[model samples]
Target: MASVREIKRHIKSVSNIKKITKTMQMVAGAKMQKTLSALLASRPYAQLAWNLLLNLAPKTERELHPLLQIRGIRNSLLVVITSDRGLCGAFNMNVIGEALRQIKDKETHFLITVGKKGRDFFIRRGYKVIAEFTGLGAPAPFISITPISQIIIDEFIKGNVDEVKLVYSDYVSNVIQRPTTIQLLPFQQEQPEEPFLAQFIYEPSPSEVIENLLVRIIEYKIYAAILESQASEFSARMMAMKNATENAENLIQSLILSYNKARQEGITKELTELSTTKAVIESLKK
Candidate 1:
Protein backbone atom coordinates (compact mmCIF):
# COMPACT_ATOMS: atom_id res chain seq x y z
CA MET A 1 0.00 0.00 0.00
CA ALA A 2 1.19 3.48 -0.80
CA SER A 3 1.57 6.08 1.94
CA VAL A 4 -0.95 8.95 2.17
CA ARG A 5 1.69 11.49 1.15
CA GLU A 6 2.73 9.44 -1.91
CA ILE A 7 -0.87 8.98 -3.03
CA LYS A 8 -1.56 12.70 -2.66
CA ARG A 9 1.48 13.56 -4.80
CA HIS A 10 0.32 11.14 -7.51
CA ILE A 11 -3.16 12.65 -7.49
CA LYS A 12 -1.78 16.16 -7.96
CA SER A 13 0.48 15.03 -10.80
CA VAL A 14 -2.38 13.32 -12.60
CA SER A 15 -4.60 16.36 -12.22
CA ASN A 16 -1.97 18.54 -13.87
CA ILE A 17 -1.60 16.06 -16.72
CA LYS A 18 -5.34 15.92 -17.18
CA LYS A 19 -5.50 19.69 -17.53
CA ILE A 20 -2.86 19.67 -20.28
CA THR A 21 -4.42 16.83 -22.22
CA LYS A 22 -7.89 18.31 -21.97
CA THR A 23 -6.66 21.62 -23.38
CA MET A 24 -4.91 19.82 -26.26
CA GLN A 25 -8.07 17.88 -27.04
CA MET A 26 -10.08 21.09 -27.39
CA VAL A 27 -7.47 22.77 -29.59
CA ALA A 28 -7.11 19.79 -31.91
CA GLY A 29 -10.87 19.43 -32.23
CA ALA A 30 -11.28 23.03 -33.40
CA LYS A 31 -8.44 22.85 -35.93
CA MET A 32 -9.62 19.49 -37.27
CA GLN A 33 -13.01 20.97 -38.11
CA LYS A 34 -11.49 23.82 -40.06
CA THR A 35 -9.05 21.67 -42.08
CA LEU A 36 -11.70 19.10 -42.85
CA SER A 37 -13.98 21.77 -44.25
CA ALA A 38 -11.20 23.15 -46.44
CA LEU A 39 -10.46 19.74 -47.92
CA LEU A 40 -14.12 19.07 -48.66
CA ALA A 41 -14.52 22.42 -50.39
CA SER A 42 -11.60 21.75 -52.73
CA ARG A 43 -12.92 18.40 -54.00
CA PRO A 44 -15.30 19.80 -56.64
CA TYR A 45 -12.62 21.85 -58.34
CA ALA A 46 -10.28 18.88 -58.50
CA GLN A 47 -12.99 16.65 -59.90
CA LEU A 48 -13.83 19.25 -62.54
CA ALA A 49 -10.23 19.47 -63.65
CA TRP A 50 -9.89 15.70 -63.89
CA ASN A 51 -13.14 15.39 -65.82
CA LEU A 52 -12.15 18.07 -68.29
CA LEU A 53 -8.86 16.36 -69.04
CA LEU A 54 -10.50 12.95 -69.31
CA ASN A 55 -13.13 14.25 -71.80
CA LEU A 56 -11.58 17.06 -73.84
CA ALA A 57 -8.83 15.11 -75.60
CA PRO A 58 -8.53 11.89 -77.54
CA LYS A 59 -6.46 9.08 -76.05
CA THR A 60 -4.34 8.63 -79.20
CA GLU A 61 -3.36 12.27 -79.48
CA ARG A 62 -2.97 12.60 -75.70
CA GLU A 63 -0.20 10.02 -75.84
CA LEU A 64 1.73 12.23 -78.26
CA HIS A 65 2.14 14.86 -75.52
CA PRO A 66 5.44 14.55 -73.65
CA LEU A 67 3.75 14.52 -70.21
CA LEU A 68 1.43 11.69 -71.19
CA GLN A 69 4.26 9.34 -72.11
CA ILE A 70 4.98 6.80 -69.38
CA ARG A 71 8.56 5.66 -69.34
CA GLY A 72 10.11 2.80 -67.36
CA ILE A 73 9.75 3.10 -63.56
CA ARG A 74 13.46 2.49 -63.02
CA ASN A 75 14.63 5.85 -61.70
CA SER A 76 11.72 7.12 -59.58
CA LEU A 77 11.18 10.02 -57.23
CA LEU A 78 8.87 9.98 -54.22
CA VAL A 79 7.29 13.11 -52.72
CA VAL A 80 6.43 12.31 -49.11
CA ILE A 81 3.96 14.42 -47.13
CA THR A 82 3.94 14.30 -43.34
CA SER A 83 3.00 16.57 -40.44
CA ASP A 84 5.64 18.97 -39.18
CA ARG A 85 4.81 18.26 -35.53
CA GLY A 86 4.28 15.13 -33.48
CA LEU A 87 1.52 13.76 -31.13
CA CYS A 88 -0.69 12.77 -34.04
CA GLY A 89 -1.00 9.00 -33.41
CA ALA A 90 1.12 7.51 -36.22
CA PHE A 91 -0.09 10.09 -38.72
CA ASN A 92 3.42 10.67 -39.98
CA MET A 93 4.53 7.11 -39.47
CA ASN A 94 1.78 5.72 -41.66
CA VAL A 95 2.75 7.82 -44.66
CA ILE A 96 6.45 7.41 -44.08
CA GLY A 97 6.07 3.66 -43.99
CA GLU A 98 4.16 3.73 -47.27
CA ALA A 99 6.87 5.83 -48.88
CA LEU A 100 9.59 3.46 -47.75
CA ARG A 101 7.64 0.53 -49.06
CA GLN A 102 7.08 2.18 -52.43
CA ILE A 103 10.65 3.31 -53.03
CA LYS A 104 13.38 0.71 -53.38
CA ASP A 105 17.05 0.86 -52.47
CA LYS A 106 18.53 -1.21 -55.31
CA GLU A 107 17.42 1.43 -57.77
CA THR A 108 18.31 5.11 -57.85
CA HIS A 109 15.43 6.48 -55.77
CA PHE A 110 15.25 10.22 -55.10
CA LEU A 111 13.09 11.58 -52.28
CA ILE A 112 11.65 15.07 -51.81
CA THR A 113 9.93 15.44 -48.47
CA VAL A 114 7.33 18.10 -47.56
CA GLY A 115 7.60 17.87 -43.77
CA LYS A 116 10.40 17.76 -41.25
CA LYS A 117 9.37 14.47 -39.76
CA GLY A 118 9.68 12.53 -43.00
CA ARG A 119 12.82 14.38 -44.01
CA ASP A 120 14.47 13.55 -40.69
CA PHE A 121 13.32 9.95 -40.86
CA PHE A 122 14.89 9.41 -44.28
CA ILE A 123 18.10 11.15 -43.34
CA ARG A 124 18.52 9.02 -40.21
CA ARG A 125 17.97 5.88 -42.30
CA GLY A 126 20.77 6.96 -44.69
CA TYR A 127 18.45 7.51 -47.65
CA LYS A 128 19.11 10.22 -50.19
CA VAL A 129 16.91 13.32 -49.72
CA ILE A 130 17.01 15.40 -52.85
CA ALA A 131 14.84 18.19 -51.53
CA GLU A 132 12.77 19.16 -48.46
CA PHE A 133 10.22 21.80 -47.37
CA THR A 134 8.84 22.48 -43.89
CA GLY A 135 7.13 25.01 -41.55
CA LEU A 136 3.73 23.83 -42.82
CA GLY A 137 2.48 22.79 -39.40
CA ALA A 138 -1.27 23.46 -39.44
CA PRO A 139 -2.57 25.58 -42.33
CA ALA A 140 -0.77 24.55 -45.53
CA PRO A 141 -1.42 26.66 -48.61
CA PHE A 142 -1.33 25.41 -52.21
CA ILE A 143 0.66 28.45 -53.17
CA SER A 144 3.28 27.54 -50.61
CA ILE A 145 3.78 24.20 -52.40
CA THR A 146 3.89 25.66 -55.91
CA PRO A 147 7.66 26.03 -56.02
CA ILE A 148 8.25 22.43 -55.00
CA SER A 149 5.66 21.18 -57.46
CA GLN A 150 7.16 23.14 -60.29
CA ILE A 151 10.60 21.79 -59.57
CA ILE A 152 9.33 18.21 -59.62
CA ILE A 153 7.39 18.90 -62.82
CA ASP A 154 10.49 20.28 -64.49
CA GLU A 155 12.58 17.38 -63.33
CA PHE A 156 10.11 14.91 -64.79
CA ILE A 157 9.67 16.86 -68.02
CA LYS A 158 13.43 16.99 -68.43
CA GLY A 159 13.72 13.20 -67.96
CA ASN A 160 15.40 13.56 -64.59
CA VAL A 161 12.68 11.61 -62.76
CA ASP A 162 11.13 8.59 -64.44
CA GLU A 163 8.01 8.75 -62.29
CA VAL A 164 6.80 11.00 -59.50
CA LYS A 165 4.94 9.28 -56.69
CA LEU A 166 3.17 11.08 -53.85
CA VAL A 167 2.90 9.34 -50.51
CA TYR A 168 0.38 10.71 -48.00
CA SER A 169 -2.54 9.83 -45.78
CA ASP A 170 -5.95 10.09 -47.38
CA TYR A 171 -8.73 11.74 -45.41
CA VAL A 172 -11.51 9.15 -45.30
CA SER A 173 -13.69 10.73 -42.61
CA ASN A 174 -13.58 12.64 -39.35
CA VAL A 175 -12.20 9.57 -37.57
CA ILE A 176 -10.46 7.58 -40.30
CA GLN A 177 -7.25 8.19 -42.26
CA ARG A 178 -5.48 5.77 -44.60
CA PRO A 179 -2.01 5.66 -46.13
CA THR A 180 -1.92 6.06 -49.91
CA THR A 181 0.61 6.40 -52.72
CA ILE A 182 -0.03 7.22 -56.38
CA GLN A 183 1.83 8.34 -59.47
CA LEU A 184 1.43 12.10 -59.74
CA LEU A 185 3.13 12.78 -63.05
CA PRO A 186 2.51 11.36 -66.52
CA PHE A 187 -1.19 11.56 -65.78
CA GLN A 188 -3.23 8.43 -66.33
CA GLN A 189 -6.76 8.69 -67.63
CA GLU A 190 -9.55 6.45 -66.36
CA GLN A 191 -12.08 5.52 -69.02
CA PRO A 192 -15.70 5.70 -68.00
CA GLU A 193 -17.73 2.49 -68.06
CA GLU A 194 -20.17 4.04 -70.53
CA PRO A 195 -19.25 5.22 -74.02
CA PHE A 196 -19.74 8.92 -73.26
CA LEU A 197 -16.38 10.21 -74.58
CA ALA A 198 -16.34 8.14 -77.79
CA GLN A 199 -18.58 10.59 -79.64
CA PHE A 200 -17.27 13.96 -78.42
CA ILE A 201 -15.04 15.78 -80.93
CA TYR A 202 -11.93 17.68 -79.93
CA GLU A 203 -12.03 21.52 -80.35
CA PRO A 204 -8.99 23.13 -82.06
CA SER A 205 -6.64 20.19 -81.72
CA PRO A 206 -6.59 17.22 -79.35
CA SER A 207 -2.85 17.32 -78.78
CA GLU A 208 -2.85 21.07 -77.97
CA VAL A 209 -5.79 20.75 -75.55
CA ILE A 210 -4.19 17.76 -73.81
CA GLU A 211 -0.83 19.51 -73.51
CA ASN A 212 -2.49 22.53 -71.82
CA LEU A 213 -4.86 20.49 -69.63
CA LEU A 214 -2.13 18.10 -68.49
CA VAL A 215 -0.17 20.95 -66.93
CA ARG A 216 -3.04 22.22 -64.78
CA ILE A 217 -4.30 18.72 -63.98
CA ILE A 218 -0.97 17.77 -62.48
CA GLU A 219 -0.96 20.91 -60.32
CA TYR A 220 -4.50 20.24 -59.16
CA LYS A 221 -3.51 16.68 -58.33
CA ILE A 222 -0.77 17.93 -56.02
CA TYR A 223 -3.05 20.53 -54.43
CA ALA A 224 -5.73 17.93 -53.73
CA ALA A 225 -3.23 15.54 -52.16
CA ILE A 226 -1.88 18.28 -49.89
CA LEU A 227 -5.38 19.21 -48.79
CA GLU A 228 -6.19 15.59 -48.02
CA SER A 229 -2.97 15.20 -46.05
CA GLN A 230 -3.77 18.30 -43.97
CA ALA A 231 -7.26 17.03 -43.13
CA SER A 232 -5.86 13.62 -42.16
CA GLU A 233 -3.24 15.11 -39.86
CA PHE A 234 -5.78 17.26 -38.03
CA SER A 235 -8.18 14.35 -37.65
CA ALA A 236 -5.45 12.13 -36.28
CA ARG A 237 -4.35 14.78 -33.81
CA MET A 238 -7.89 15.31 -32.54
CA MET A 239 -8.38 11.60 -32.01
CA ALA A 240 -5.03 11.24 -30.27
CA MET A 241 -5.65 14.17 -27.92
CA LYS A 242 -9.14 12.91 -27.13
CA ASN A 243 -7.68 9.53 -26.17
CA ALA A 244 -4.98 11.15 -24.07
CA THR A 245 -7.57 13.19 -22.17
CA GLU A 246 -9.62 10.07 -21.41
CA ASN A 247 -6.56 8.18 -20.18
CA ALA A 248 -5.59 11.09 -17.97
CA GLU A 249 -9.06 11.21 -16.48
CA ASN A 250 -8.87 7.51 -15.75
CA LEU A 251 -5.48 7.89 -14.05
CA ILE A 252 -6.75 10.75 -11.88
CA GLN A 253 -9.73 8.68 -10.75
CA SER A 254 -7.51 5.74 -9.84
CA LEU A 255 -5.14 7.98 -7.89
CA ILE A 256 -8.08 9.56 -6.01
CA LEU A 257 -9.34 6.14 -4.93
CA SER A 258 -5.86 5.17 -3.77
CA TYR A 259 -5.49 8.41 -1.85
CA ASN A 260 -8.74 7.81 0.04
CA LYS A 261 -7.74 4.24 0.88
CA ALA A 262 -4.30 5.25 2.07
CA ARG A 263 -5.66 8.03 4.29
CA GLN A 264 -8.24 5.66 5.82
CA GLU A 265 -5.56 3.10 6.67
CA GLY A 266 -3.36 5.75 8.23
CA ILE A 267 -6.20 6.94 10.52
CA THR A 268 -7.07 3.36 11.51
CA LYS A 269 -3.47 2.58 12.40
CA GLU A 270 -3.18 5.72 14.62
CA LEU A 271 -6.41 4.91 16.46
CA THR A 272 -5.29 1.28 17.06
CA GLU A 273 -1.93 2.43 18.44
CA LEU A 274 -3.63 4.91 20.78
CA SER A 275 -6.04 2.23 22.08
CA THR A 276 -3.20 -0.23 22.71
CA THR A 277 -1.21 2.37 24.67
CA LYS A 278 -4.27 3.25 26.85
CA ALA A 279 -4.82 -0.48 27.61
CA VAL A 280 -1.21 -0.88 28.70
CA ILE A 281 -1.50 2.12 31.09
CA GLU A 282 -4.74 0.71 32.59
CA SER A 283 -3.05 -2.66 33.23
CA LEU A 284 -0.12 -1.00 35.05
CA LYS A 285 -2.54 0.94 37.33
CA LYS A 286 -4.44 -2.27 38.21
Candidate 2:
Protein backbone atom coordinates (compact mmCIF):
# COMPACT_ATOMS: atom_id res chain seq x y z
CA MET A 1 0.00 0.00 0.00
CA ALA A 2 1.19 3.49 -0.79
CA SER A 3 1.30 6.33 1.76
CA VAL A 4 -1.74 8.60 1.95
CA ARG A 5 0.28 11.68 0.90
CA GLU A 6 1.52 9.96 -2.24
CA ILE A 7 -2.02 8.80 -3.05
CA LYS A 8 -3.34 12.32 -2.57
CA ARG A 9 -0.68 13.67 -4.92
CA HIS A 10 -1.64 11.15 -7.62
CA ILE A 11 -5.29 12.07 -7.20
CA LYS A 12 -4.52 15.76 -7.62
CA SER A 13 -2.49 15.15 -10.79
CA VAL A 14 -5.22 13.03 -12.31
CA SER A 15 -7.82 15.68 -11.48
CA ASN A 16 -5.77 18.34 -13.26
CA ILE A 17 -5.40 16.14 -16.30
CA LYS A 18 -9.14 15.57 -16.35
CA LYS A 19 -9.78 19.31 -16.35
CA ILE A 20 -7.44 19.84 -19.31
CA THR A 21 -9.00 17.05 -21.37
CA LYS A 22 -12.49 18.30 -20.65
CA THR A 23 -11.56 21.78 -21.82
CA MET A 24 -10.06 20.42 -25.03
CA GLN A 25 -13.22 18.43 -25.66
CA MET A 26 -15.34 21.56 -25.44
CA VAL A 27 -13.03 23.43 -27.85
CA ALA A 28 -13.08 20.61 -30.35
CA GLY A 29 -16.86 20.38 -30.21
CA ALA A 30 -17.26 24.07 -30.91
CA LYS A 31 -14.88 23.98 -33.90
CA MET A 32 -16.62 20.87 -35.24
CA GLN A 33 -19.96 22.66 -35.52
CA LYS A 34 -18.44 25.37 -37.72
CA THR A 35 -16.53 22.96 -39.95
CA LEU A 36 -19.63 20.84 -40.40
CA SER A 37 -21.47 23.84 -41.75
CA ALA A 38 -18.71 24.58 -44.26
CA LEU A 39 -18.64 20.94 -45.38
CA LEU A 40 -22.41 20.88 -45.89
CA ALA A 41 -22.39 24.13 -47.84
CA SER A 42 -19.70 22.86 -50.23
CA ARG A 43 -21.49 19.64 -51.18
CA PRO A 44 -24.10 21.17 -53.45
CA TYR A 45 -21.59 23.23 -55.40
CA ALA A 46 -19.29 20.27 -55.81
CA GLN A 47 -22.15 18.06 -56.96
CA LEU A 48 -23.30 20.60 -59.51
CA ALA A 49 -19.79 20.98 -60.85
CA TRP A 50 -19.50 17.20 -61.16
CA ASN A 51 -22.84 16.99 -62.94
CA LEU A 52 -21.73 19.66 -65.38
CA LEU A 53 -18.58 17.71 -66.14
CA LEU A 54 -20.59 14.58 -66.79
CA ASN A 55 -22.84 16.41 -69.21
CA LEU A 56 -20.09 18.38 -70.96
CA ALA A 57 -17.61 15.54 -71.21
CA PRO A 58 -19.89 13.48 -73.38
CA LYS A 59 -20.21 16.29 -75.92
CA THR A 60 -16.52 16.43 -76.75
CA GLU A 61 -13.72 14.04 -77.63
CA ARG A 62 -11.47 13.22 -74.68
CA GLU A 63 -8.26 14.08 -76.57
CA LEU A 64 -9.32 17.73 -76.94
CA HIS A 65 -8.99 18.27 -73.20
CA PRO A 66 -5.64 17.46 -71.61
CA LEU A 67 -7.27 16.72 -68.28
CA LEU A 68 -9.59 14.13 -69.83
CA GLN A 69 -7.00 12.21 -71.83
CA ILE A 70 -6.05 8.91 -70.24
CA ARG A 71 -2.40 7.99 -70.55
CA GLY A 72 -0.32 5.01 -69.56
CA ILE A 73 1.22 5.07 -66.09
CA ARG A 74 4.73 6.44 -66.15
CA ASN A 75 4.99 8.36 -62.87
CA SER A 76 2.30 9.55 -60.49
CA LEU A 77 1.70 12.52 -58.21
CA LEU A 78 -0.15 12.16 -54.91
CA VAL A 79 -1.63 15.02 -52.90
CA VAL A 80 -2.13 14.16 -49.26
CA ILE A 81 -4.22 16.16 -46.81
CA THR A 82 -3.88 15.79 -43.04
CA SER A 83 -4.24 17.83 -39.92
CA ASP A 84 -1.66 20.40 -38.85
CA ARG A 85 -1.95 19.41 -35.18
CA GLY A 86 -2.96 16.04 -33.85
CA LEU A 87 -4.96 15.01 -30.79
CA CYS A 88 -7.39 13.87 -33.46
CA GLY A 89 -7.26 10.17 -32.71
CA ALA A 90 -6.46 8.16 -35.85
CA PHE A 91 -7.44 10.80 -38.37
CA ASN A 92 -3.95 11.62 -39.64
CA MET A 93 -2.75 8.07 -39.19
CA ASN A 94 -5.57 6.61 -41.24
CA VAL A 95 -4.97 9.04 -44.11
CA ILE A 96 -1.18 8.59 -44.10
CA GLY A 97 -1.55 4.82 -43.82
CA GLU A 98 -3.92 4.56 -46.75
CA ALA A 99 -1.67 6.76 -48.91
CA LEU A 100 1.40 4.69 -48.15
CA ARG A 101 -0.49 1.47 -48.79
CA GLN A 102 -1.64 2.70 -52.19
CA ILE A 103 1.73 4.02 -53.30
CA LYS A 104 3.85 1.18 -51.99
CA ASP A 105 6.31 -0.36 -54.45
CA LYS A 106 5.56 2.24 -57.05
CA GLU A 107 8.29 3.06 -59.55
CA THR A 108 8.04 6.82 -59.26
CA HIS A 109 5.96 8.60 -56.66
CA PHE A 110 5.85 12.36 -56.15
CA LEU A 111 4.16 13.84 -53.12
CA ILE A 112 2.40 17.18 -52.64
CA THR A 113 1.47 17.23 -49.01
CA VAL A 114 -0.89 19.59 -47.21
CA GLY A 115 -0.71 19.88 -43.43
CA LYS A 116 2.31 19.58 -41.17
CA LYS A 117 1.48 16.06 -40.12
CA GLY A 118 1.58 14.54 -43.61
CA ARG A 119 4.54 16.61 -44.78
CA ASP A 120 6.60 15.76 -41.71
CA PHE A 121 5.72 12.09 -41.91
CA PHE A 122 6.71 11.72 -45.56
CA ILE A 123 9.86 13.82 -45.26
CA ARG A 124 11.10 11.95 -42.19
CA ARG A 125 10.72 8.67 -44.08
CA GLY A 126 12.92 10.02 -46.93
CA TYR A 127 10.07 9.95 -49.39
CA LYS A 128 9.97 12.26 -52.41
CA VAL A 129 7.92 15.21 -51.27
CA ILE A 130 7.91 17.66 -54.18
CA ALA A 131 5.86 20.28 -52.41
CA GLU A 132 4.62 20.84 -48.88
CA PHE A 133 2.18 23.41 -47.54
CA THR A 134 1.05 23.53 -43.96
CA GLY A 135 -1.35 25.59 -41.86
CA LEU A 136 -4.20 25.41 -44.36
CA GLY A 137 -7.27 26.85 -42.71
CA ALA A 138 -10.28 24.76 -41.86
CA PRO A 139 -12.67 24.88 -44.84
CA ALA A 140 -9.76 26.09 -46.94
CA PRO A 141 -10.43 28.97 -49.26
CA PHE A 142 -10.65 28.39 -53.01
CA ILE A 143 -8.11 31.10 -53.76
CA SER A 144 -5.59 29.44 -51.48
CA ILE A 145 -6.24 25.90 -52.73
CA THR A 146 -6.21 26.94 -56.38
CA PRO A 147 -2.44 27.14 -56.46
CA ILE A 148 -2.11 23.56 -55.27
CA SER A 149 -4.57 22.38 -57.90
CA GLN A 150 -2.86 24.40 -60.58
CA ILE A 151 0.51 22.89 -59.79
CA ILE A 152 -0.81 19.39 -60.30
CA ILE A 153 -2.63 20.44 -63.46
CA ASP A 154 0.52 22.02 -64.82
CA GLU A 155 2.56 18.94 -63.99
CA PHE A 156 0.10 16.69 -65.77
CA ILE A 157 -0.10 19.00 -68.78
CA LYS A 158 3.66 19.17 -68.99
CA GLY A 159 3.78 15.35 -69.08
CA ASN A 160 5.58 15.29 -65.74
CA VAL A 161 3.09 12.93 -64.09
CA ASP A 162 0.77 10.48 -65.78
CA GLU A 163 -1.83 10.57 -63.05
CA VAL A 164 -2.64 12.68 -60.01
CA LYS A 165 -4.50 11.41 -57.00
CA LEU A 166 -5.77 13.00 -53.79
CA VAL A 167 -5.70 11.27 -50.44
CA TYR A 168 -7.99 12.57 -47.73
CA SER A 169 -10.37 11.60 -44.97
CA ASP A 170 -14.00 11.79 -46.03
CA TYR A 171 -16.48 13.06 -43.52
CA VAL A 172 -19.31 10.57 -43.42
CA SER A 173 -20.78 11.69 -40.11
CA ASN A 174 -19.87 12.73 -36.61
CA VAL A 175 -19.13 9.12 -35.67
CA ILE A 176 -17.51 7.99 -38.92
CA GLN A 177 -14.74 9.28 -41.14
CA ARG A 178 -13.19 7.19 -43.88
CA PRO A 179 -9.77 7.57 -45.44
CA THR A 180 -10.00 7.53 -49.24
CA THR A 181 -7.82 8.07 -52.31
CA ILE A 182 -9.37 9.49 -55.45
CA GLN A 183 -7.91 10.01 -58.90
CA LEU A 184 -7.99 13.70 -59.69
CA LEU A 185 -6.68 13.86 -63.22
CA PRO A 186 -7.43 12.17 -66.51
CA PHE A 187 -11.04 12.23 -65.38
CA GLN A 188 -13.60 10.12 -67.17
CA GLN A 189 -17.23 10.56 -66.42
CA GLU A 190 -20.25 8.38 -67.06
CA GLN A 191 -23.27 9.83 -68.84
CA PRO A 192 -25.63 11.83 -66.72
CA GLU A 193 -28.10 9.44 -65.06
CA GLU A 194 -30.94 11.86 -65.60
CA PRO A 195 -31.54 12.52 -69.29
CA PHE A 196 -31.44 16.26 -69.63
CA LEU A 197 -30.88 17.65 -73.10
CA ALA A 198 -27.86 19.92 -73.50
CA GLN A 199 -29.22 23.28 -74.65
CA PHE A 200 -26.53 25.90 -74.26
CA ILE A 201 -24.53 28.20 -76.54
CA TYR A 202 -20.87 28.47 -75.75
CA GLU A 203 -19.39 31.98 -75.64
CA PRO A 204 -16.13 31.30 -77.54
CA SER A 205 -16.61 27.66 -78.55
CA PRO A 206 -17.73 24.39 -76.94
CA SER A 207 -14.19 23.12 -76.56
CA GLU A 208 -12.92 26.35 -75.01
CA VAL A 209 -15.86 26.52 -72.58
CA ILE A 210 -15.43 22.88 -71.64
CA GLU A 211 -11.72 23.40 -71.07
CA ASN A 212 -12.29 26.36 -68.79
CA LEU A 213 -15.04 24.51 -66.91
CA LEU A 214 -12.72 21.54 -66.42
CA VAL A 215 -10.11 23.77 -64.80
CA ARG A 216 -12.65 25.31 -62.46
CA ILE A 217 -14.08 21.86 -61.70
CA ILE A 218 -10.68 20.54 -60.78
CA GLU A 219 -10.04 23.45 -58.44
CA TYR A 220 -13.48 23.13 -56.91
CA LYS A 221 -13.06 19.41 -56.41
CA ILE A 222 -9.76 19.92 -54.61
CA TYR A 223 -11.28 22.66 -52.48
CA ALA A 224 -14.24 20.50 -51.62
CA ALA A 225 -12.05 17.59 -50.64
CA ILE A 226 -10.02 19.83 -48.35
CA LEU A 227 -13.22 21.02 -46.72
CA GLU A 228 -14.31 17.45 -46.17
CA SER A 229 -10.94 16.66 -44.63
CA GLN A 230 -11.18 19.64 -42.29
CA ALA A 231 -14.62 18.64 -41.12
CA SER A 232 -13.43 15.09 -40.50
CA GLU A 233 -10.45 16.38 -38.55
CA PHE A 234 -12.65 18.39 -36.25
CA SER A 235 -15.07 15.52 -35.73
CA ALA A 236 -12.24 13.13 -35.02
CA ARG A 237 -10.64 15.57 -32.59
CA MET A 238 -13.93 16.10 -30.78
CA MET A 239 -14.48 12.38 -30.37
CA ALA A 240 -10.90 11.77 -29.32
CA MET A 241 -10.94 14.56 -26.77
CA LYS A 242 -14.29 13.44 -25.45
CA ASN A 243 -12.93 9.96 -24.93
CA ALA A 244 -9.80 11.33 -23.31
CA THR A 245 -11.85 13.44 -20.92
CA GLU A 246 -14.01 10.48 -19.99
CA ASN A 247 -11.01 8.24 -19.43
CA ALA A 248 -9.33 10.92 -17.35
CA GLU A 249 -12.44 11.26 -15.23
CA ASN A 250 -12.52 7.51 -14.73
CA LEU A 251 -8.86 7.54 -13.74
CA ILE A 252 -9.43 10.42 -11.33
CA GLN A 253 -12.28 8.52 -9.69
CA SER A 254 -10.10 5.44 -9.33
CA LEU A 255 -7.27 7.47 -7.80
CA ILE A 256 -9.62 9.20 -5.39
CA LEU A 257 -10.91 5.82 -4.29
CA SER A 258 -7.36 4.62 -3.71
CA TYR A 259 -6.47 7.77 -1.79
CA ASN A 260 -9.51 7.51 0.45
CA LYS A 261 -8.77 3.86 1.09
CA ALA A 262 -5.17 4.62 2.02
CA ARG A 263 -6.22 7.52 4.25
CA GLN A 264 -8.80 5.36 6.04
CA GLU A 265 -6.28 2.63 6.61
CA GLY A 266 -3.81 5.13 8.11
CA ILE A 267 -6.51 6.64 10.38
CA THR A 268 -7.61 3.19 11.51
CA LYS A 269 -4.02 2.21 12.35
CA GLU A 270 -3.47 5.44 14.33
CA LEU A 271 -6.76 4.92 16.26
CA THR A 272 -5.79 1.32 17.05
CA GLU A 273 -2.39 2.46 18.38
CA LEU A 274 -4.02 5.29 20.38
CA SER A 275 -6.53 2.88 21.95
CA THR A 276 -3.78 0.50 22.90
CA THR A 277 -1.70 3.31 24.42
CA LYS A 278 -4.76 4.62 26.34
CA ALA A 279 -5.48 1.19 27.81
CA VAL A 280 -1.83 0.86 28.92
CA ILE A 281 -1.80 4.33 30.47
CA GLU A 282 -5.13 3.69 32.26
CA SER A 283 -3.81 0.45 33.66
CA LEU A 284 -0.60 2.16 34.83
CA LYS A 285 -2.67 4.90 36.54
CA LYS A 286 -4.82 2.35 38.37
Compared with the true structure, model 1 gives a TM-score of 0.88
**Per-residue alpha-carbon lDDT of candidate 1 for residues 242-264, written as tens digits (9 for 90 to 100):** 89888988988888888888888
Q: How many clashing pairs per prediction, in order? A: 0, 0
TM-score: model 2 vs. ground truth: 0.93
Off by over 4 Å in 2: 196-198
State the displacement of the C-alpha of residue 118, model 2, in Å, after optimal TM-score superposition: 1.1
Query: Which pairs in model 1 have colliding backbones?
Result: none
lDDT of each: 0.81, 0.86
TM-score of each: 0.88, 0.93
